[model samples]
Target: MISQAAYGAEPNKDRRIPVTVLTGFLGAGKTTLLNAVLSETSSGKIAVIVNEFGEAGLDHDLIESVEDEIILMQSGCLCCSIRGDLAGTIADLIERRDDGFLRFERIIIETTGLADPAPILQTLLIDPELARTTRMDGLVTVVDAANGSKTLDAQFEAVSQVAMADLILLSKTDLISAKVTDALSMRLNGLNPTARIERPVAGQFDPKQLWGLSGLRKGVRQEDAIAWTTSAPEPKIDPLANLSGLSKPKPVSFAPTPHDTRISSASIVLDTPIKDSAFDYWLDTLIALKGPDILRVKGIVFLEGIDVPFVFHGVQHIFDPPVPLKNWIGDDRRSRIVVIARDLTRPELQRSLDMLRAHQPKTGTKEEVLLGHD
Candidate 1:
């Protein structure tokens, strides 16, 4: 959990609102899940910004019809459309909220079905005012269990959505068999090993599950931190000779799909603390050369001469400022970094780490030899 101090001061001192980006492909039950969230009275006042108001099936009784663009829900929530500019829309909401015209605890942005989440995530990090006033809580993606495999096989966008998700809600599970749903879950795990996958009951889930999902915040548990930055090891393949050949079994061929080969998810662990210069140089070079292909990079870094470790997060080229875990305890000092990239292989990423290791500051001076005097 991120304490109020994580935002730099007390809650009253820092009014940075947390924003959650909700996204999914067409017919993935995004609307159903969103409606469930809004209908739940236990969920605090939430301001929802949708790409299109006409398409969002918000309850009529809840909407007070404030204006052409804004609809005030009886539950004390606000609903608005993008009106062409996301940043401008959010800025207006902030102004109104400050002026006592609106009330909401957090903001949720729902993107179009075909939307790519990378650009939306970049906007939050790149916009100065947005970055100052709002912090990204996390990204929640809805996947249709019945059609997930077909969608992934047909649309790379759907695959990308699965890859960049922090929380994946498997919707429409009731429409499919358990065997099929389990297969989809395994595929999702392969696409993104870090994301938490849940099969929401009847397309409904607790709103609280969406909050504080970054896992890079202060006061977070060490296990949670490790889970967020560590990738599961690839399954080992055994030799065919080990199998029983009493009946002369048929030969098996192994092949990976194009999508699987395109996106690579891997992690590297370093035993020693990294020098400041070396870490910066390696990150800068990697982002400069492969920013577009890079989807997400997150890590817990322990720098030389620094007592507390810094948690860093990045989406492509844009990155949030590293926050120090002042209260972090334990003697485990290994640095761990996870990267999800497109068209980048594990060996390539390893080579980049090798560069960082090669550039590390040399330690200990050797004593001068007295061979000449002897």
Candidate 2:
């Protein structure tokens, strides 16, 4: 645990404060980073939020021997599946500040390895409500220099984790030889050229390095973070199942022995444009049917004659209104859909869409058959 005497960053007089993000693959030494920051910073009075133990338990584990250390974190506040919704947790810190619980200069959040950095950043960047109160300093990634190479090669989450860092710490390099360390450093640089790399001796150096966050940031976009090597459900599920999975044994929407769910995701590319009204009707029916199960969806659509691709992001039932993009990221102009959730069958979702789309009426194209208009 970094002591209060070690911290130096004072709260901003007007409105700016640094909030450091401590992220890395599990057991990569994020706790070590927190310990370093807490123990060495010249700043006085700092607050830390972590995921491992009750927030302060992580603090205590970091510097367990320090007798004067006063650490505090409630268990209820620290949930297991907490990824990036720390915006709510951080908001609580402001309340505590008003009540005088602690006069910390900076805020630190460490996430579990299974988490995605994009959503966390989105909670910071996209949430205009939270942005008003907090400003992002930078992302600090603690890398396991010893076994990082294998993790990167094997895990999609690891690649995403490394891709989103602004400052990277390569810990435990001394345990390995110089040659292996140099190779890993090069690989890290290739993944994120912008991040400054520091090989710390167990985070036992000057705390000034992690202090300033002006240099740590990236273009606010998920294009760099989006990755999918994993496969979704089989290609047998119906398109209408996009709304509701085939749960009923009696066959409500074509039950095929229960492999997929009611709310499924499928990618579609049209040679021609879809009528705006028709698209709305389809979306409406889908949501009405099974919006509850639609976990996350990302797609780039080439709408009829619209030159630019339409980018869409949706979480569960909530969706960001579609945004027009200047162009697609790759050669395949066809739409790409990444659906993440349980009980979803991709094949049924696609077929239902195909049939419904074929049934569109020709009065400037609207849903009369599906909506029972004519």
Candidate 3:
């Protein structure tokens, strides 16, 4: 039997701080968003960490230089640049907060433009001390609407950033035409069907909207779980008919680039409850074989003989503890899993899921009890 501890299951003893990882390719307007969040008085107390404090443009009067390491902001927030190790920097911050030196409710780490966010996420999951003190709130990626398509075609890092984001903030929309924005949105939707896409209004966004994005959080609702696991419906484009009654304009479609082709997102649905053994085998085999290629995996599973369903989330090979929805009450018992991977096809994922379905309880199989039916 697989123990719950193996899945990283444990009850929270105290309120762990929430951390948001912000990432984007070069010139994606991440700095602008950070400035907006820091300058706004209503954003509450936040701790912002970056690779270089100078490059972040901390010129706003709301920010007051405290010391070489940390800068105190007038909005009751703090901004600092990472000195050495990320884990160490976070540990120091936590220590200060516990020692009554700093006051902040959330932490945001802005990665360099060329950085991949998966490794950072893996660190948060595997590190025992960090996991106990912090919870992953969400991954927010900023994409420049005008140059996003070309960036995706040229850089695999940008593609990975978009693929792994829970909330994508589309920047530079005002500079691009409406048609261009729609095409880029379509491309992003194809890359990450489960992510929530939003265009920040005039380089401004509500800091509150970025929190509590993880669907596997404690006391998660059924609707939130379904929203996180299910893919967005394919958009419908109506044919445009001219007044001359001639042929209608065909729908606009963005062709997948080479980099875009490298990443694929697909969801699997099983009508019946999956046996625990089946789920364990399928997940273990899949992770063992394609762990490096998997960018993200999330599911709401209904296991046989278990009354309540559980929500599981994973990044690459490391998985967060499965959260059981004991309060779930409804007729829906179907299991849904969404996988986003690089160099993995939908057929390959389906084949693995087939193994789980094959293990479902068969009629009269238990009655036979290791004896020949004949």
Candidate 4:
């Protein structure tokens, strides 16, 4: 039977959509990389799907679809077997164009920073469902100049991020110490002898640095994601496969739940509610300091002052203000946030959350605070 993902007919029979997979550490600037592409190229229409690391969809909010068909996949890492499920999303994007919902020809799937390019690339070579129509154009991996060492030392995904990259973009080079940048370059060379490395602040280098990477080598040598290691976990780091890796182990994922922890990305709901001031501070600080380290951030918070819940979404350094939601989506009024970052630890994230909650008021309930009667 013809698959629904096949869109009832071949999108371009005898031709395929060249798909570029972008991977980097959680906030290494992949989204900015995509937006930059919009300005530099006039390729056959371009469609982008931004996969965030949260359960609730948020990546879509930040995407400025040049056309509605320019879609975003605010779901989990597209490197897993589950990424195969996104065949439907691909189908939808194509159908929309076929129906004139959009006007683009090429497609880009930008994975969360924490993603391993292995599984994602494998899907292109292996998934029978998607392989027929989509051609793997290349893999682009973004690395942060400031903390690339720590990420490479502590996270396995970091090494895989470099190894699988056809184009290695070293972002935020101006922020790191010169010595650190040199060390990072050496390490990158040690890990992946391949890949063309491009620096972020090299006086507006050609954005074309991200182009022309063919998927895995013709043979099966590229399929062994495990052999590509010796960089992550830095011996003690033990980065998980690209399929599902986490920096810390506070939460465990079960396959049966709707939580869908099968991928490297996951979401957490705070038991303690966050104050508006607190959440705002979190946004400002996270974006200011670690923004480049983050791939995407989206959440519905019960702000301390607003009567309605505030919705916020950000992709790396760029952020959009919060929009008010009609009412709490569900009665479990606790604050919920979905973070898709590469190599970020649970302890560190909780610390970030705790830091955001440090000085919040405990005098009244959320309703009392919102009414201005508190």
lDDT of 1 by residue, 113-136 (tens): 889998888888788999888988
1-374: candidate 4 lDDT, tens digit per residue:
11112122222232556778878886677656665565444343466666643421333444443223233322211111123356777766666667964556566777766665555555554555466667666677888878776776667777667754656778897785444565566556434443456666644766555544542112212212112211222111223422355544222221221111111222444545555555666667766766655644555555444444444445455443233444233454555555444344444555665564465445422211100000
Clash pairs, candidate 3, are none
Report the number of the highest-TM-score candidate.
3
TM-score, each model? Answer: 0.85, 0.49, 0.89, 0.47
Deviating ranges (above 4 Å) for candidate 2:
1-14, 54-85, 215-374
Q: Which stretches of candidate 3 lie over 4 Å from their true place?
A: 1-14, 233-250, 361-374
lDDT of each candidate versus the true structure: 0.76, 0.52, 0.80, 0.51
Please list the Cα RMSD from the true structure of every candidate, rounded to 1 decimal place.
9.2, 16.7, 6.6, 20.0
TM-score for candidate 4: 0.47
- Model 2, residue 162: distance off in Å is 1.3
TM-score of candidate 2 on Cα atoms, chains taken together: 0.49
Question: Which 10-residue span in candidate 2 carries the lowest summed lDDT?
Answer: 365-374
Candidate 1 clashing pairs? none
| Residue 4 error, candidate 3, Å | 6.3
User: For residue 303, what is the lDDT in candidate 3?
Assistant: 80
- Per-residue lDDT of 241 in model 2: 31
Better of 1 and 4 by TM-score: 1
